[model samples]
Target: MDYEFGMLAWSMAGHDKDKLYVIIKTEGEYVYLSDGRLKPVERPKKKKWKHIQVRKTIPEELCSLTEETIKNEEIRKVIRRFSNV
Candidate 1:
């Protein structure tokens, strides 16, 4: 699957398994993810593409964010809205 920015994904390995995260950036075989709380947008967690199960839902607001404009609060809101957490 082609990973893109703003896409939601679930961590499938490690301690973060089943936790929701957003795809902030992608590089080669790795993707930067943020849950908006523990792993905020400012400091995204880098994991392999195979480690995250991509979700079909993409937050339209996030798609317009640039690196400089991405905010942790907004990311959190999006996750909470979708995951109902």
Candidate 2:
């Protein structure tokens, strides 16, 4: 899977399994994820790509985020919107 910034994914192997997160950064086979609550944008969880299941839904708000922009609240809102569905 080709990981890009702002992509929504779910942790599949760790204690956070089934929890939603947004891809903040990607390095090789590892991707940094943030839930915007437990794991804020300032401190992302680095997990292997194989451990995350990419979601088809990509929030529109994600497109506005950049490496310099930190929008933890938006990330949290997007996750809440999808997880409820």
| Prediction-by-prediction clash tally | 0, 0
What value does the lDDT take at residue 37 in candidate 2?
91
* RMSD per model, one decimal: 1.6, 1.2
Q: Compute the lDDT of residue 83 as modeled in candidate 1.
A: 87
Report the C-alpha lDDT of model 1 over 1-85, residue by residue, as the tens digit: 6998889998999988998888899999999999889998888999999999997767787877876688888888888887874
Q: How does model 1 score by TM-score?
A: 0.89
Output the number of the TM-score-best candidate.
2
Q: What is the lDDT of residue 40 in candidate 1?
A: 87
- Model 2 clash pairs are none
lDDT (Cα, tens digit) per residue for candidate 2, span 1-85: 7888888998999788898899999999999999999899899999999999997556788787785695888898888998998
Candidate 2 lDDT at 73 equals 89
Q: Which regions of candidate 1 are displaced past 4 Å? A: none
